[model samples]
Target: MSAAPSPAPPRETRQREVISRLLQSAEGPLGVPELHARALNELPRLGVATVYRTLKLLQEQGAAHIVTLDGENLYEASGRGHHHHFSCRQCGRVYTLNTCPVALPAGTVYPGGFVVEAHEVTLYGLCPACAPR
Candidate 1:
């Protein structure tokens, strides 16, 4: 006989829906306050605690990743493949860069015996809109 399928884990329906909307509408990492603010439009009862808890759960499940910048914890959906990020200083907007400029030679090693595996680069600058004319 075939093996039985595993049951799904318990879900927080409203919280999940809120997270879905945030992930879908966001183009970059979103802070909890921003997420809550946007989600509150549709879910009047949405709470800050729910957003935090759901973010934690989603990060644990690899469904989302944390982007820390300027002492703030921002959340973004994962599974987009290898890429870098850029943060605008003036507007405080985060952007995803498709190209990775760092190229290491074969058998390169660090001074502390650390081997390179993967890396994430975050560039800082003024975005087009915020740049001086």
Candidate 2:
């Protein structure tokens, strides 16, 4: 008897949905709990572990990113290749800047033989609403 074909990959579907909700929500970055809760709205049985796993997959495929700032791990959409980020301390909000100010002359900063694949730029401070006078 012939062996039955393997089932389709569920991780891909879950990962796509995860990335879609993240971009549509546009909440800068979200923690696992927050992301998982949101995913549950569409997928009632979504689990936190699945959320983490899918997020890792998304990061590996360059579809999303995880930012660890001030002891918090947050996830965000990353289809624009790579970019910088700004997060508010008081309000606990996050923002993605259009570009980074820090720049290095090509072939100077990086090691002679090493290749620079990607970089993460992050800044943390009080946002406009949370700033103190």
Candidate 3:
């Protein structure tokens, strides 16, 4: 007989709810520090360790994912679907690019006969506010 799937994680606590809402509503992915700071507004006594644990749980549950930009890891809700990111060097901020520019078809074969299963693209440049007119 096939084994049954494991039970889902316990229902979210008040703290996890705050963290999850922040991730879902953020304009872009947020690093731990940013997420913690924002969460503190609603949950003044929230601990950094709790934030770390909650993020880990979210990732394990496929409710969130990490985006690494300029060596910093950021978190965003998984419901965003297929998309990429852009990093502003001057502002040190990462933004989500809702529209994908890549047109590669699935199962595309490379020059060496390697098939493309997935891809990630990150664009780096100055954001509008940082760009010189």
Rank the candidate models, highest TM-score first.
Answer: 3, 1, 2
TM-score computed on alpha carbons, candidate 3: 0.88
lDDT of 1: 0.82
Quote the lDDT for 109 in model 1: 82
Q: Model 1, which residues run further than 4 Å from truth?
A: 1-7, 105-107
Question: Model 2: which ten-residue window has the lowest total lDDT?
Answer: 102-111
The number of residue pairs in model 2 that clash at the backbone is 0
lDDT of 3 by residue, 81-124 (tens): 78888889898878889988898767999998999998888889
Estimate the TM-score for candidate 2. Answer: 0.65
| Highest lDDT model number | 3
Error of 3 at 64 (Å): 0.5
lDDT of 2 by residue, 1-133 (tens): 9999987655448546755666556747777877777777778887777787787877876777767877888888876544677888787778777776667434444556765555667788987788887
Q: If scored against the real structure, what TM-score would every candidate get?
A: 0.80, 0.65, 0.88
Worst 10-residue lDDT window for candidate 3 reads 65-74
Candidate 2: the clashing residue pairs are none
